[model samples]
Target: MAVTSEPVLAIDVGGTRMKGSVVDAAGRELHGCTRPTPRADGPDAVVEAVVAFAADLTARAGGVAAAGIVVPGIVDEDSGTAVLSANLGWRDLPMRSVLEARLGVPLAFGQDVRAGGLAEVRLGAARGARDALFVPIGTGIGAAVVLDGRPVSGSGFAGEIGHLVVDAGGAACGCGLRGCLETVASAPAVARRYAARTGRATPVPEIAAAAGRGDDPAAVAVWAEAVDALAGVFATCATLLGPEIVVVGGGLAESGALLLDPLRAALDGRLSFQRRPRVVRAALGDRAGALGAGLMARERLQAGVGSAR
Candidate 1:
């Protein structure tokens, strides 16, 4: 059946919150809602919450034809299983099957960062680029690599760029590594490091402003360290993958050039015989995940791949 005219449900399941939206085939949202993720209550509780939230949205949308969901961690989209989400505390959960049974519809599932990358490529900053890197820096950092205009999953474990070690002897990471990029480069890490040095808790934006203005030595040092760490990663990426553009998103990317300009400069300072990628801020912002989910659902419908009944 050609159900392209019907609306579809899209959900982006984050560690701390779940965002849902219903969109028509043209990708314009018809309805949307956000709910707190009860992660502290356990993984099963989080799954149940997703089901309930999705159900409510479906009903509110007057019954969507299908649902598209994206989440963090290791996700095997081929099998529709959430391989592992340390934040959500799940391993090998058959999420798509469960959701199909509960929601009574076929759906599409994907990793959140990859989904965000897709949205940016199709509709946002990375549009018209054949190869790009999409990295969203928030509570943690993750990358989505687009090669030949398609996001590569590497069998569900590809884009763990946050775990890449930058300071091998520095802070311990939750993933049992020392001095991973996320520990020093993420938004929270920047603020935490600033507080530890200055005895004052300051956000990334303020720290960035202070660094740019050269007013605070602590802020300058902390921000410079983060930008340097990220530059090293991007330099390595430029050498290995040679992406034409790198789209930086999430809360930290909101700093705009305060982040990208320094990052581009630091990356250039490191690269001598490598392809330099243009570092740009993501155009979709936080809604990229949900919009990507909607795109996935519409693609599923267009391809005649119905969700498991």
Candidate 2:
């Protein structure tokens, strides 16, 4: 094994695609690419695709010093295993070990949302906050909680706020739970709910636009439900965690003031003595996960762990 200053290979695995980058020690991306995840081909194929992606990235980088890979699901960071991912259809997969063997590089493996949160803390919006929450509400809702400047994993099952019961009688969630926050606040949920109400399938962005324009009463109602649900969740999180800031990311966050203004107002109305966390949009956009993966790889390299086997 040799210690080198070579850039790291970072990969962020999503349900739909896998993003790869060769990132320098400074966390700057040197090269990048994206590939479709072979999820339709089954879990085994997804794993193979990840390995192939890493190997290709390593080669493109002329040899990476280390690698970081983040995926969605119940990821046991300590064990370097992806326990389960309903979207990817995998279970108890030892992703770190497999990638290490296949790529012949030291690897850092973690959950995607957690990685994004870490990235936000280390290099983005939550940089100075010791207590913070990063919630990315995309096709689904997931969160990353940082306490005392470090992410709280709860042994990989910690941040599933999306499944929290915000509306006990609202709607059923994919997690087999009724009235989950995700049912009301997630991007897909907003689109679905709007379609269900209007008998017209409108994308979330369109609904948000309509709400912004104040033209469609149905759109306004749908958006309000999402904002209200989100505010409720934020209030609960504030009561429990006392986060100084809540960084909102993902597709929904793109609505900017359209989402944040109403959310902030609603959240303020709900809080009594709880510290009102400043809710803001994520600074990293869709690249947070990939950048976080890079940061994880660099940290592992600096720690001298995950040495090449």
Candidate 3:
């Protein structure tokens, strides 16, 4: 088979599923697929699934120039290692080496949230911004901090803003912290808190809708708490990072103004002498990670070409 021209495979591994795509040089996805992450099957199985997914995309694309994979956790990008991922049950996994050996292709490995942030800055909501924050609040909350038009990995542990303590005595977090921002502001947390209060298991969007209608006190209260916690976190980030914009993504971001308006107000209220960032919705949606991975793969391909010359 003839090798595909300037096409690369991109994979974004999440706690629930893995998204794969074949993207061309222009950053257009030619093909894409999603598969269960098989977290219950163990971390090793997850790694195998990711490799297999890449191989499948390569075959479908008639072969790719390179591949990029991003996973959650403390990713040592310099060493191409998935240092730790509580959700995926991995630790010290040399994912890049393993995938390179398995697929016989160059691989670019990175942290999922950071990859999404890169996409946001380079191609989406935070484009052209010198400093920005990309926070995606889904089943979990994570952030990507971009400074001076570059994403800061901080040696692989920089952007775990979700674990930042917001409420000292609040809910317990999976990371063994109490009252972490994620426990209150994540999409899952919003649904869980509303369910606990109203004894009705509703999705985050439904809860936001109820709050918008002003018909359910429980929904309104839960949403308010999430907004307050998120605002506090953003205020702290703004004070420290001085990001010009905060691009909110993930499942909760779908709520649009229901989440952003109050969040902006609360964040503004908390700031005394800090740069007030424009809180906006993510433009790339769920595809940010995959596109970012594609960008990484293209970079790897270009590096290889340059080195060969």
Per-residue alpha-carbon lDDT of model 1 for 14-101, expressed as tens digits? 9898999999977899999899999999999998999999989988998898889999999887778899988788899988888878
lDDT for model 3: 0.88
Give the better candidate number (2 or 3) by TM-score: 2
Per the 3 Å backbone cut-off, how many clashing residue pairs does candidate 3 have? 0
lDDT of 2 at 271: 99
What residue pairs are clashing in model 1?
A: none
lDDT (10s digit) by residue, model 3, range 138-215:
888889999998788877889899999989989988889899999998888888899899889897898999898889
lDDT of 2 by residue, 212-305 (tens): 8999999999999999999999999999999999999999999999999999999999999998899999999989999888888877787777
TM-score of 3: 0.93
What residue runs in model 1 are displaced by over 4 Å at the alpha carbon? 306-309
Q: Judged by TM-score relative to the true structure, which candidate is superior, 1 or 3?
A: 1
Candidate 2: segments with Cα more than 4 A from true spot: 1-4, 306-309
Lowest summed lDDT window (length 10), candidate 3: 300-309
Q: What lDDT score belongs to each candidate, Candidate 1 first?
A: 0.90, 0.89, 0.88
RMSD of 1: 1.9
